[model samples]
Target: MTQTAEAAAENLPARRESRAEKLLSWLIRGASPAASHLLLLPAAAWLLVFLLLPVACLLALSLATRGPYGTVVWSFTWANFGRALNPMYLPVLLRTAAYAGSATGLCLALGFPLAYYLSFYAGKRRETLLVMLMIPFWTSCLVAIYSWMIILGRHGLLNDLLGRLGLIQAPLPLLNNGFSVVLGLVYFYIPFMVLPLYGSLEKIPRAYLEAAYDLGASPAEAFLKVTLPLSLPGVFAGCLLTFVPCMGDFLTAEFLGGPRNFLIGNLIQNQFLMSQDWPFGAALTALLVLSLISGLYFYQRLEARQIEP
Candidate 1:
């Protein structure tokens, strides 16, 4: 009787699990295709309301004309876009691209080795190091930029330290230049590059490296032939993450690079705020959005090709 009671008690939990699983399966089977799609309504509505609607409005605004009094007129024209591509603004656009590209390159150079170290050699300190790396994000971006200003200003920390060390009699002119803008950009965006690279490198199995070793390949050869190619996806993601935001950034150039270091973002901001030329600003914004979208499309095609046999 005792044995039978124990057996029944053990079977009770299994019976309950089976009943629950059966209920789940029945619910799934009974769900209509329309009902399944209805589950996506909230997410679809969010994108439509927040993303698509704003972009459509921007496109419409870009096609509209600016009144002589600086009001937005409903008249359709391509003049705004043409004006955006004028030689006057072409140099600014090119400079913005150059800054973004420089920052992206520097980030890749720094982040790849750091990520590799974190993935393969950080050992017990990996989590701690990662947390430290992310610590800068805890504060506001403006705060970070202000800190950089303090460090880079003529009478700032770096200059004071150098002066005390007798490195120079005069303070270095570090602020308000293209170099400062790019430095700010690299400092801010390098973490974005490192995290993605670390994720990619960490996912690579040690077995692959071991296999490469067994094939009489040196460590450097193994890394070059096996690790680097597999990590290209991370490189692509990191570059995309770094470059796009760098191109659109205004604060770094505004605070560090000053007027001479103006970027596309600064131009758009001045157009909308200072000049009250919303149509032209919208056109510039639309062009930037289109360019980013085209890049994304190309990346997708490349990724698809890589995935195919």
Candidate 2:
């Protein structure tokens, strides 16, 4: 009798909470469509003031002309766009694409196995492993990049270890190159790839795998046919996440790649900051945004085709 009373007392607050939630939900459902629209006004207004305003300003700036003294003039011209698209800037754009693509590929290769292991084989330790994977995000990105510099620098950890092992007479040229830039990008963005892949992989029902096995399909064949196809959405999302930022990353290239491996991002940064050419920088930014939008459109088309009956 005492235990039953205790149980009732314990559930009383939960019951009250459930009733309160039901009441709130009922109130919301009873709200008029005009009221519902009013609720979204704040968000819409926020986007307009913050997002749309800035973008409009940038577009205006991109269309405007730069003065002789580096001031932005209200006069309109397409020269900035033409200069950004010219042959002289083609190499920078191409290099940006190449670096971003390389980093995306490397991240996919590394993240897939990690995600696969976490989803399938991690068993009881999945949460712990995930925490470890996310630990890097707890600190500043600048600190993480600086740590890589310490590891890859001429007198840094790797060179010291290699020297100790009698690997070579001189410190290897590990830093200030394309390799370091890509390495930094992969290190920074691998989590973005892994998390999406794990989300998709984990959602795949175990029963499907069991059914495949019951149909006399080998593990390799089953994975190739079922798991890979099911995980393509995650792969696409991960690649998109990694590649887009890499294309606009000036810090990684500036710190690790130096002058010779200049990507479009560095060029944009130079124009905006060093050269004080706001119009040209805005034009380049617009071009980058357009390219990304085109890629997104293609991705949507591909996704839609895959979903077609």
The sequence of per-residue lDDT tens digits that candidate 1 reaches over residues 256-292 is: 9987889999999998999999999999998888878
State each model's CA lDDT, in order.
Answer: 0.91, 0.90
The C-alpha local distance difference test score for the whole of candidate 2 amounts to 0.90
Find the candidate with the highest TM-score and give its number. 2
What's the lDDT for residue 44 in model 1?
A: 96
Q: Write the per-residue lDDT of candidate 2 for residues 1-309, one digit (tens) a residue.
A: 999999999899999999999866765785676656666789999999999999889988999889887799987899999999999997889888998999999999999999999999999999999999999956688998899999999999999999999997899999999899999999888998999999999989989999999999999999998899888888888888888998889888888887799888888888888899999999998988888889889887887776563
Q: What's each prediction's TM-score? A: 0.87, 0.88
RMSD of each: 7.2, 8.1
| Residue 209 of model 1, lDDT score | 97
lDDT of 2 at 277: 94
Ten contiguous residues with the weakest lDDT in model 1? 30-39
Q: List the residue pairs that clash in candidate 1.
A: none
Q: Judging by lDDT against the true structure, name the best candidate.
A: 1
